[model samples]
Target: MAKTKKNVNEMSFLDHLEELRWHLIRAVIAVFIAAIAAFIAKGFIFDTLIFGPTKPTFFTYDILCSISQSLGLDDSFCFNEAAFEIQSRTMAGQFSAHMWTAITAGFIIAFPYVLYELWKFISPGLHPNERKHSRGFIIISSILFFLGVLFGYYVICPLSINFLGTYQVSDKVHNDFDLSSYISLIRSSVLACGLIFELPIIIYFLAKVGVITPEFLRKYRKFALIIVLVVSAIITPPDIASQVIVAIPVLILYEVSIFIARFVTKRQNSKALKNV
Candidate 1:
């Protein structure tokens, strides 16, 4: 039997649109199911997950304190309190917040299935060899995403919460944080880091398509470092120590992506030569 290769580029406009519609429909269904589950788990979602990092007794704080003691460093990780209280300013605010929170939670939980669906839609258009080589797309992308989310939650969220929550202008005023503001920090940190962690995957495909070169990455590495630090600073605390910590992992990922692209391009060239 002939391989059923569908050349999507050769399809008519309506056909292309129809194919895209199915991919989107599947992704939406996955998200909806995950959201409904999250909505029903109000206890675990709100108290355990959302408020976990903000507390002094959170696991991240405890682990950091242990490390600090081992290193003979002052208890930099110790926080007596966040010094802020969250509240709703209007009617329906709490209800609106709950609905939106569940939706965001749904998207996060459904991320892996969402990526799998997207890969399925795009893979049919790839050459057979390309598809075979990228067979681990769903697994690899999902791992990267989870790593990013963990980094955001354990590193970024804690730092931001500690800094902003503790900062005070005057003794006359108290910190009464809005519910929306609290949720936005968690949402942005998790989502932003999740996307940023896909640098390797993005660079891999770009290189496969001849859009990026390892040599180019090496040539502009110093510039890339500057950009990474700037991004880290924008998202993290203004302190040099916090910025450095965030930038280090990202820089490592960028360097790793360069190596991946080099290996991929070399493999592609070798295959071409063998064919010739």
Candidate 2:
């Protein structure tokens, strides 16, 4: 379906802004309420989810150990606990970390509702046909986002924490990591993957609008692989193994996005032919 011109829309600028305000308000309320719920479940969040990666018995570590054993490498990478300690370097550091962590957790948990609000705002500009086609937007995007978050938390963050937390140039150089640093690692892992997982949605929109195409994605597939590996290397441990582990899933997602783009274009062609 054709999109309405933004400037020619019935709503005036002020009216559009007002409409946007309501969407933002609803989104904020959703996040805030979810955060409060997460805050009340402090034990589960702080110990079970947040700190689980630091323990050797964590599922990620166990999987890594098994992989290492198969490769004839010492499973030293699978540790019972990270050798580093998290400390608060400032008076308000611990409290600040807690508050922000809760907020981020809230945002993560409230992601679906947030997407719903966004879709509500954008849907008004779409044709009725387009709106109908987008019926599953919220569910599909939310599932992809949560899957990415789990991967980051369970796979990427744990590997990173296990590796960085243990790396030492000298015995004297202790790994007394600040609370803020630890939280940053976790936050980055969660948020980065959350955003990255939206690639399919992005490609969908781009393909829908004719900006990106299946052929374009296919033409530069090798280049995309390099970029994905580089991105994985940036966000993960230095080891090739870790980088490959992270890159593989992202590459697969990219391939899936290309297929989605192709399918969309094919459907559009079929529809156009039917109309003619």
TM-score of each: 0.93, 0.94
Clashing pairs in 1: none
For the record, the alpha-carbon RMSD of candidate 1 to the native fold, in angstroms, is 2.8
TM-score for candidate 1, residues paired by index: 0.93
**Residue range 215-249, candidate 2, lDDT tens digits:** 99999999999999889989988888889899988
lDDT of each: 0.87, 0.88
Off by over 4 Å in 2: 1-9
lDDT of 1 by residue, 1-276 (tens): 012234666677677667777878989999999999999998998899888888898877777677768878776566667799999898988888888999998998999999988887788789998999999988899999999998998989988888888778998889999998998999899989988999999999999999999999999999999999999999997887679879999999999999998998899899899999
**Global local distance difference test of model 2:** 0.88
Best by lDDT: 2
